[model samples]
Target: MTVLSDTSIKKAVLSGELSILPFHDDALQPASYDMRLYWKILISPMRHENGRTVDLRKEPNHTFFVEPGRFVGILTEEKISLPLSMVGRFGLRSEFTRHGLVAFGGIQIDPGFKGRLAISLFHAGPELIPLKLGRKMFTVEFNQLADQASKGYDGPFQNQSTFHKMQKDFILNAHTTSLAEINTLPSEIASIQHRLTMHETFYHPKREFPSISELAKAQGVSPINDITELSGLLSEEDDIDTFLETVQKWRRGNNNDE
Candidate 1:
């Protein structure tokens, strides 16, 4: 098997031997091309037997946050078609790995496979990770097979270009566990509800507590809605840690004044 070089990959794409819809020349790397994250993702519900699909496009800014230790399935933005002569290997980009995200599940594209790749992403980092729509999250490296298979891939996953729910039978049969583990759904939901209720009681916008902007103003500082806006307010010489410390001091002063 020979791994395709950047030049060969471009040639194959141009000659119609390979197809990557909505391709961008800038996405081409030295050996692989970057694939962006799509808008939809599948996540395991509190119940182990059920799964849920989340569409980030329905949310503001087409952004979704994945909590640490959560596992979700995402699709690639580009639909790819591979001829029988080639196979594709998918891998997580280094940038995401640095944030402790690991890609799991189907990593290899069988010859003749045609679809947007489905990827299972596991967040192993300590902090929540934000995934933005259309951001490159993975890379695909194409390789020429030694010989074309007599029969092309025609598996259950062929042409799976959208978020797909895991079949119930597949889940029940694939992973066997004790009855206790299978019955934790109710407790999990209750726990989640309790946390949400507490959060609403303490921090909901409707509560009497002053908004971040109001607090900032009371402390004689510009209001900051988010980390991005806070960063913008800082000079190049000002480090984020120092700025955050100053904000904390101001917040404390405002509380004392109150």
Candidate 2:
């Protein structure tokens, strides 16, 4: 098998050996063809479920943001078809890769395949990646096989129409969890837990409060040795009413002594 040069690639496309719709002269490269971004996209929802997305074709904007630390699926502007004798290899354009965009896709296009390419993109960069419609995002190089395989590709994704039809938008451990929001979840949970702990310490700190016996000793009262009486007053817990009564009585006795 030999890699097809630009001239050979053009000849094959012209002769129907390789089919690409909406091909542009500018997109033709020295040894490959550029694939443009299509209008439709399904982004990882902003911390939400239900895949609930919008079609960019219907919207006024021609751009979508590949948010930082999130993944998105997009379609190619051109439809592709390849004969069994030729295999294609594709990758994200270096322009997009320079900005921390990672594209997940198969390395080779199986023969006898026809469909719009679905590229899943992840933004590992710090900022949003604004991708415009019709932008050339991928470069695909074709190679001619010396011998055509016995069978053509007939997998589940052979003739997929849309990105959604090709694969799931995102796979997460929790169904209600959103991959886009995964970055901020730990901080949010920590904040809530801290607040709850602070509230509990401020309002209900029985663990830190002294017991009735310790209070009696501090006040110079006699060693009230009856466990039954202690239980009656404390009731297996710290009784605020009992604590208040005991303090009041001690204070009154101290006043008398003064």
Candidate 3:
């Protein structure tokens, strides 16, 4: 299969083998055609803005803001129809890619497809991007298949002239969280953990808890395992661990009858 040049593309259009409605000469390239942004609208869910929809039929604003991290869907100004012998490749212009515009859609137009393209896009730049109506944003490159496919394109999206229901739902229920805020969650969690463990260690860090072994070393070399010795040492010992060890020594000696 070979890609169609601008001259060949026009011939195919003139012959009714390919279709590009409302076509403009300036939009044609060496081997592709640029599709302009439709004036219908761009919907972004904004906690700051009062509403979620952008019905241009009522509103006078012709431009939409793609804030950092918000996902939005847009339509092309032209409708396309491809014959069974022709297929197409699709993507956004490189100029928009440099500004951190990520375009999302199927890259291939199946043979004999007829539809207006609806593209999902996100602005990932540090600042917000304002997109005006009729702006050139997408490109479609037509190519001729070696032979006509045995079958023609007949998918759920075929003859799609407007946004799909799924696309509408996405805009209707978009989350307000920005990607920038999501990135800092790990550090925020780490800070909370450190706060819970702040300050000097409780009691002593030498051992998990004070034991009879620690007491034995503090008072004398060997344990005082006699009851009479324990009663006298307990009266003098002020520390909790020392007092516990004094009682333990007497209990061990009595149990073993030593």
Candidate 4:
């Protein structure tokens, strides 16, 4: 795919072919844009292959719970209208990833892909970041299509307005007997916790729990009321590498579950 240049991206933005406002990047390169995180994350139940209902918006604004190593999808403030010939993908910045954060999602827009673009976002980190609504999440880079295909994403997810949890219902109806035998639930929970933490550390670094005690007060971690006790628990763990790896795995798994 041919990558769009900074100049072309600006042109597209100005012409209304691509929709995003308050564009703030020094270079304005198409390889990446500086995106901000949206505060409101919408979670939904996974769907079945036969198109049966698993969830019916039972909880509004209560999307997926992003923990470490989970891949949850969310939308963006910017709405896109790609040309019938151009397609692209969204990628998370490395600077954010180093902090144990990862983001992904952008479908292959065919030659006839139309309407506003929806991003499939996932976080694989160690901390939970309560993303606000209407926040910029990531920069999108456009790529040229190889002779424009015919098929586009006009399926169930088309014209999706908010964060679409397209996989929730399926999980709810999965085979309980088989899932229990394989020990799935525990692993899934752990993954969500891991990624959510990474997202917190990377996207919302300043807000991470100051110490174990502070973390405990929150639901996931232990509840250590005293600062001294929290400090002691942190000090006891010396292997930084092990800790990071464990968190990362958890976040990735969380996304897969969604």
TM-score of each: 0.62, 0.70, 0.66, 0.46
How does model 2 score by TM-score?
0.70
- The model with the greatest lDDT is 3
Q: Write the per-residue lDDT of candidate 2 for residues 1-258, one digit (tens) a residue.
A: 899988998898899888999778789999999999888776664455545454666655777676676667777889889898988888899988999889887868888888888877777777778878888988998989999978788877777777544456462211333344778888999999999999998998767778888998999989657766665645457778766877887877853431
Per-residue alpha-carbon lDDT of candidate 4 for residues 1-258, written as tens digits (9 for 90 to 100): 788888778777788776555466553654655555443343322322222221213323532234443344444555555675677666555554655555544435444444444544344455654444434455567876677657655666566554445443432233222212235778878999999999988987785336766656665765558777756554565777766777787877843332
**Each candidate: how many clashes?**
0, 0, 0, 53
Per-residue lDDT, model 2, residue 32, is 93
Choose the strongest candidate by TM-score: 2
Which lDDT values do the candidates have, in the order given?
0.78, 0.77, 0.79, 0.53
Off by over 4 Å in 4: 21-27, 43-71, 102-107, 115-123, 128-135, 146-153, 168-258
lDDT for model 4:
0.53
Off by over 4 Å in 2: 45-50, 58-60, 164-166, 169-190, 205-219, 223-258
Candidate 1 residue-wise lDDT, 1-258, digit = tens: 999888888899999999998798888998899999888776544336544567788867888876665666778899999999999999889988999888767788999998888877767776767888898988999999899877778988789877555632232233223333436678989999999999987776565688788888899996456777655566789788866777787877853431
The per-residue C-alpha lDDT of model 3 at residue 24 equals 88
* TM-score-better candidate, 2 vs 4: 2
lDDT tens string, model 3, 23-92? Answer: 8889989999999987665565654653255544344466676778777788888999999899999998
Report the poorest 10 consecutive residues by lDDT, candidate 2.
171-180
